[model samples]
Target: MSEQLVEALRGAVGDGHVLTDPDVVEAYAVDWSRRFRGPVLAVVRPADTAEVAAVVSACVTAGVPVLAQGGNTGLVGGSVPGADSAPTVILSTRRLTRLDPVAELAGQVTAGAGVVLADLHRHVRAAGWEYGVDLAARESATVGGTVGTNAGGIRVCCHGMTRAQVVGVEAVLPDGSVISHLGGLPKDNTGYDLTGLLVGSEGTLGVVTAARLRLVRPATGSAVALVGVCDAADALDLVRSSVPRGVRLLAAEIMDAGMLRHVCDVASVPWPLPQQHDHVLLLETESPADGDVAMDLPDDRDVVVALDAADKARFWSYRERAAEATAVLGVPHRFDVSVPMGSWDAFVSDMRARLRGIDEVEEVLVFGHLADGNLHVEVLGPEPEDERADVVVLAAVADHSGSISAEHGVGRAKAAYLALTRSPAEIATMRAIKAALDPHGLFNPGALLPSGPASPSRSS
Candidate 1:
């Protein structure tokens, strides 16, 4: 970053909050994926919305690009900073956290962008209410980052993804204007819906400061059934019949056998007997207090955790630990793709066979929120530090009519390949829309859009 940008950042946020040290900036340089790290002028930690706005405004004036980051647990290279990327400032959304709790029957709770997902769950769950999104990175992924990526985790089957749960949003436009329609009146259909436009913009459209998200009562009873299937196709059949169990089906997850072995090795969870099957699916169900069915059946599922605090944590740990397990193997290529549900059987078989035939590839681990047709793949191999494998795997997703990302935002890491799934005309429209919201291309430039790609229809 240039001296002018550093001076402006220091002025907006007190000197104590502005970090220009190479050591500190280096820490925020890369994400969990370690894919594409960029050059950073400084790391600005804002304490409140005002400070956040000030920092953003200063970056615009100085012509210094800004990258909004949260817990840095993102698998995509979205949060990474690099040196080739001109002078830039890293806006760390770490300090803007506050819990605003409302005790109404609907149980409304507003959280700051920096509040971690898991902590938000614990805060409201005591009222028999809960924040619906659950992911392995819940402990680290902040509300702002989750909203930026529209994250979908294990609960997607029953509760839906983050975008579905976000009834309101509070973001700062490129010009540092705060647009507060966060969880606004449900009946206001007077104009176009701008909240949806910003939610999945990947912080390229604007910086998300806070959100009014949907909250539901914690399931009175919950259970997880680990089922072994002979092939990937069999897993698809199970989901079609099992998901309609109504609210009882909290999540329906699938995992490859290779992943299970890694899970057993890295986590406290044990492996199955001599045979755990090549493909496995974990079906989760829930029961409300009025029904109380979960309490009545003890051996109903592979994993069950009721209102008991300890029991719930134990079962959830196993599912969320998949990321950690794969991370230990290597910095692998990961993608979140969504395809037609019916083609899952054929897609899995074909992709697995094709990947297996490649000598450059070593192992493949697949798991995700199957309910949304969103699959997460951690493609890795014996080659210890190989990183390009992720890029190759992502490009291959386009061949299957799958998205480059099922939920995770197209942060800087995926920015280079976003066009693979989106068509030329669609990309042109995107550029036009981006120009409307961020005219000079100042808001998180170089992300979500290739420097030369066209923009889409933007409302806000």
Candidate 2:
């Protein structure tokens, strides 16, 4: 069966595009965090949507599961196959790099799933527009992967998540049928929003081949400020009081002192502030012609504002280089969760105390978009397979009336604990949708959905 499937894949895409060698397949089998890996019969790279449809058709006929991978930069185990998955073929989207010219009149662009986020940013910026989604992994993260997870980045507070930017999508469903809606219409009022449904489905519904993304006008004269704060609550208060009356708030980020120090050491950059406090708040605001927005901030606490572009980049490096620095400490159990605004500080305090109590938790680093109440938690000192830390952290999130998964999709990491955030009825509806779209379960099985009965609800 493996031989026949390989032959079919080779026929759909060229022989050279289908890789069966163990040495080469290893790179595509594992995820970015080096946590999840599985065996693959072969890796097939398709060039266009038609080719992707053909490949999916072949795999469906062969009774083999297909895992669609795009940049493979996902921290969760969604983009890659699992260790116990059946003989699967990784449908690589790296070759589907069709980027259409920017629709200047509509302020949108249609890009293939394989198009890197950084490249899209450059392409749209050249047309006097911005993509709005900016993250550290922009250089390697692909459009389809970001769309698959509905990624929220630093600019989410300003421009909203990927779902808002996505106007249309072109995908190949589990039955090998193509759905193309790349018109970029502003008002469709269509029956069942298929694009929105697939945006955060995590590849369980279908493989996103291309997307029509809405672009935003570039910000004019921005100023960045790094201020010291006592805690998350203090940071939130500072964000409200610091910005001037007319200045527009673009971003608000918060990080612990320990995490900031680690990032500074790993990046080999000088500390931006004079005195470090327990937590630091980074704010980016729109400036006027004079570019003196930082002058309006209160002088009570330590503040370092960057008016020039170079200085702003330097200040942002501390926040952007955080994930890279955490990776240096080895594979850390990473969790991206969100709590309510009122309970943000208390959740952080409670979560930190709970994590410290764990014997396997050696170090805990916390940082995230402060205004949005999303926190990225990285825990070190646990083996990759040890899930004790997962239970402790996710359970605490449920206890605080928070979501188990925030910007990042459930993937296989938090699928079981999904019931903690979602009710049984919601999970059943998701399953019904899954059955309607993918009855054979060929598109990304064992992801975004729990395998067994939903766990009892724990949310307050």
TM-score of each: 0.88, 0.97
lDDT of 1 by residue, 1-460 (tens): 4787777778888889888778877778867876667777788998888888898888888777788888988776677554367756888888878878754554567788899988888888866687888888877899999988888877777778788888778888888888888654655786777778878888788888888877877777665555666554676676565544455677777777787778888985666433457766666667554324332222322433233546556545556677788887776677777777765656666667767755778777887766677777777763534545544555556666777778887876567677777877877888888998778676667777777544221211
Q: Model 2, stretches more than 4 Å misplaced?
A: 454-456
Each model's lDDT comes to 0.73, 0.89
Superposed Cα deviation of residue 88, candidate 1 (Å): 1.6
**Candidate 2: worst 10 consecutive residues by lDDT?**
287-296
lDDT for residue 393 in candidate 2, whole number 0-100 = 86
lDDT of 2 at 183: 97
Per-residue alpha-carbon lDDT of candidate 2 for residues 21-74, written as tens digits (9 for 90 to 100) = 999999998998899998788999999999999999999898898999999989
